[model samples]
Target: MSFEERDHTADILMHIRAADTIGLFTDAGHALMKTMYRGPARPIEEVSVTITGQSLEHLLHGFLSELLFESEVQNIVFCEFEFQIRDGEVRAILRGEPFDPAIHGGGTEVKGISWYGLSIRQEQNEYACDVLFDV
Candidate 1:
């Protein structure tokens, strides 16, 4: 399926009747990751996972956080991430490989989730969220 940039930014949306509860849309920014990752360019392996929720911001944070945590635990690092949301359902495709322990920050470890300074807002057609992940 061909997709055009919905906007200069990565925020994605689609137009469909409200009844189209099962619609699917893909963002170009996400499509690029299919071939390789970004931070240091690595071949992609698996690129598909689904997420369901109510708030977009919440879902996004949870999804990305889970991916990063999994990567750290499994010693897998990916540079690119593609996200798709429909009817509050999210699908993510991650591409990358497990990098050496030395590649990451010095003495860093995935602790757990945190509530400190967590925030998300959508105003005047703009949306943004901030999540603090424990190290």
Candidate 2:
């Protein structure tokens, strides 16, 4: 699984591709991490969450939004994601450490994850999606 930054006029757009549903959600975290912090950080701190949504898109947005909340509130930038999504429910454990401005500040700050243009779809054996990060 992998994620790539794409051009956007007002926000950060990331195209994520993975082998399965879980991978799609997992890579989304990496995409967010890449957008928010440039420096390398170890997974010393852990954040866990269990959330539910109305639909797939809602679940995705909710999950990403939760991560964003943790990042800002805890002053941490996550580097790893482990998620289980089923029946509109998500249980996840994320790893990150305190954000050090000296090393992590060069990256753009993601204020929020946008609902606009957010979508997840399956093509063949792979899952692909796009998420917009409001910065």
Candidate 3:
């Protein structure tokens, strides 16, 4: 799995490529966390989220949105994710620690995940998509 930050006129854009659905979610989650928080020396807490969508694209949006919600409501930064995807639903276990300004360097405050320019496709053995985050 791999991801790169793309140039956007406003907000942040990320393009992710993975070999499977689970890998895609894992990479996207890590990319989002890295964009907002530096990291914690060690994980101190865990969060679990389950989301269902009508399609793969919607599922991706829901996954990212849930991550954003957890960050804001819990005041934490997630670093690890283990998830399973089946029938347009995702059940995930995320591990991280409460955000500490001193340890987890601050970055752009992502407001929300946007569907603009969103795309999800399968090419040969890989799945790829572009995600836009409102900042």
Candidate 4:
């Protein structure tokens, strides 16, 4: 799995590539947390999220949005993710610790995950997509 920051006009754009659908979701979650928090200084807590979507693209958007919600509501930053996708639904276990301003340096504050420029497709055996985040 891999993720790269892409150029966007006024938001954050990320290109995610993975070997499978679950990998795509996992990498995207990691990318979102990395974008907001530099890195986890300590792994102290874990959280789990289960969500459903109409399709793969929607699933990705929903997954990222859920991560953002967790950050805002629980004041945590996720560094690791385990994803299970089945029939348009996703079950994810996120591992990380509470965000400490003093320890975990802050990065860009992502307002929400955007649908703009969102695309997902399979090339050969790899799955890839471009996700835009409103910051």
Strongest candidate by lDDT: 2
Q: In angstroms, how far off is 85's CA in candidate 2?
A: 1.4
How far residue 102's Cα lies from its native spot in candidate 3, in Å, is 0.6
Across 1-135, the per-residue lDDT of candidate 2 in tens digits comes to 489888989888999999988888899988888888888889999999987999888888998899988898999989888888889799999898899999888888888888877878889989899899999
Which candidate, 2 or 4, would have the higher lDDT against the true structure? 2
Query: How does candidate 4 score on lDDT?
Result: 0.85
Candidate 2 vs candidate 4, TM-score winner: 2
Each prediction's TM-score versus the true structure? 0.57, 0.94, 0.94, 0.93
From the highest lDDT down, the ranking of the candidates is 2, 3, 4, 1
Candidate No. with top TM-score? 2
Provide the lowest-lDDT 10-residue window in model 2: 113-122
> CA lDDT of 21 in candidate 2?
81
**Which candidate would rank higher by TM-score, 1 or 4?**
4
Candidate 3 TM-score to native: 0.94
| lDDT: the better of candidates 2 and 3 | 2
What lDDT does the true structure give each of the candidates? 0.45, 0.88, 0.87, 0.85
RMSD of each: 9.8, 1.1, 1.3, 1.3
Model 3 per-residue lDDT tens digits across residues 1-135: 499999999888999999988889888888788788875535678989999999988888999999999988998888888888889798988888888898888677888899987788898999898898888
